[model samples]
Target: MRAPARLREDGPLRATLVAIGLAVFGIAATQFTTLPAFLLEPALQGTPTDASIEARTMLLILNFLGFVLAGGIYLSATDRGWSYVDLRMPTRRGWLYVAAGVVGSVVFFVAVSALVQLLSLPTAESQVMDFVGDDQTMVLVMILIVFFFNAPAEEFLFRNVIQKRLYSAFSRMQAVVAASAVFALVHFPVYTAYADSLGATAISLSVVFGGSIIFGYLYAKTDNLVVPTVAHAAFNAFQFGLLYVALEYDIEEAQPAPSHAIDVVLALC
Candidate 1:
């Protein structure tokens, strides 16, 4: 009873910790569930090109479920009703934030790509392209996933649940930084594959952290998840759309972004 009471009484700090734990569990869940399903898919049998596409698609779906469950259970235990997280479609002002986020993210992405290139840093191939492997059908499906499910779900879990809870535990700046850092660090496992070496990995991770800070800032500043959510969607849509065009045209000249993905898939973990 005492332990349960503490869990109940604990505020943002406790919620944040629990969110992190559940996130780990969620990632583990992917290992057992999504990974195997993808590997054993009859459609992908003898089609190694489809290996990452099917596997990661399932992984994204499961991760969304896990994040939602984590946030939901935390809300229930903390007695913070659904209203505690503001996810309503933003009014006109919120739209401005969303627009800014999209433009800012694009500007940031371009700037970072140039900086990475100049610095001789490693850049990651677009994971979407890596996975779909000339599979047009999967490409279209992933586009839909990116625009609809992946973007909104990640914002709800990370910004609405995790980052928002952190605010109760620290100053807004501190909380945003902490949340953004955790957001960035969680992606460490991905950098190795995206980067060529430790130095390049660091640079790539910095881009992720920087982008998260922007996302976190928007969430914190606007006092709503709407800004970051839409912004994230737009950003992802831009990238995925670009990738689709590149693939369809077989455009070899376009440089893949040096992305240190934030949301596991950089859209959601």
Candidate 2:
């Protein structure tokens, strides 16, 4: 199956608009998926300062489903089917990219953190930090969620769907940049929840943008969805694991840096 002629023949302007529209719809769909989590909130209320594990777990699961729903709908609408996504097991060379992606992501985050601190840029912490508190168990659960569900879902929507859609009218790098921008923009509201100023929000979004570019690039280079998905999952899982260690050992330095918290809720989109 193939996409409609209009979609396949889209000029730059039309492609940009369509890609943005699809991205917006995907974001809305994911947000809508979290609605049911609210129902569980009252029933699963925890301490006043913390969200219940049940509620958090429900939200994570719903988020995964929502992203998958968005991707599925797009494929159906375009008549492209799952085959259009280029999903396959990674080759040995692809595995090298996966390793590079994971390591590069960590290095990128560390470099960005150092730059932010050096420049004294204002940055916002994720609201998730409040809910996580000192709960190592919650952090452990989040690690599992990010690895198994969150990373795969977001990669499917943003990289496989939206980025690939843009390729009809843009260069590979252009598509990656445009899709990364959209990914970062969609995350704005979540970061703003704890932002004290626009600078703080911008800093957080910049990190997201950079990280997304890495994911997009991996997808483009490998032409294998699992490459980026596993890379994304491993990076996020690493952060959550670090947080768990921080909570367990009370190592402040081991805690996620300001923008690093963005990964914690990246799937909550």
Candidate 3:
């Protein structure tokens, strides 16, 4: 009875618990690996040059863990017997969805940037000059990896797996909120990385968590990760492009932006 009950009764809950637990593990792992930078960057490197590299590597590993946990949740919670779906291939309509998401994200991003100023939140402004210098090959490869591969992988994990699985046991709003909270928690490292003040980090995290819930809702309603993934990828790409433009063009100031991802979320029900 115990064995059968464990397999069938509390499967989703168990999976969710595991998912959250693994999140802690992943964060601790990254923190442990990068502790040297936090303590020794100023003394050894004279600057935080290698600090950013460690952060990026940590992000990559976290994403990988997210994929695993999401996959586990999807399999455990859903009745569907399908194995992992290939995110690399999209249908014709999927492409259209991607385009629509890009446009919607841009509008939302610009609007939120303007709106956050009204709240008197301190948003920093800085830019990186191109992704890998003037090398065209590097840019192309980076775009391919980010858009075609990494973005889709993340979307499938969050939307199709974690969000959907949670919705089975939790209310739609609760599921969205949970997924978004987890998403924000996964990004805690970045909060510490770029923020100079605790106040700034708190504000930024609120914005991120809030916006993530919206994205989760959209993903739930659409029942397709393609739209959300495309939006996510496009937003990042635009940000990269913006960084390049700002760094190369010598802008006196670029406003710090807050994410408003919830704008795209319209409940299908």
Candidate with maximal TM-score: 2
Candidate 3 accuracy as lDDT: 0.51
Candidate 1 lDDT tens digits, 206-261 = 88788888888889888888789888877876776766677788886453452233
Best by lDDT: 2
> Alpha carbon lDDT of residue 141, candidate 1?
68
Please give the range of 10 consecutive residues that has the lowest summed lDDT in model 1. Answer: 258-267
Question: Which residue pairs does candidate 1 place in steric collision?
Answer: 263-266
Candidate 3 per-residue C-alpha lDDT over 27-56 given as tens digits, one digit per residue, 9 for 90 to 100: 344344444444543321232222344433
Q: How many pairs of residues collide in model 2?
A: 0
Which of 2 and 3 is ahead in lDDT?
2
Using Cα atoms with residue i matched to residue i, what is each candidate's TM-score against the true structure? 0.80, 0.88, 0.62
**RMSD in angstroms between candidate 2 and the native structure over all alpha carbons:** 3.2
Q: Per-residue alpha-carbon lDDT of model 2 for 1-269, expressed as tens digits? A: 35567766889888778778877787678678877876667432334135578787787678677878988998998898988888889999999999999999999988987888789888886655655677777788877887778888889888899999888878889999999988887777776776899889998888889999999999989878999999998998887877788878889866785324233344343
Q: List residue ranges in candidate 2 displaced over 4 A.
A: 1-8, 43-51, 257-269
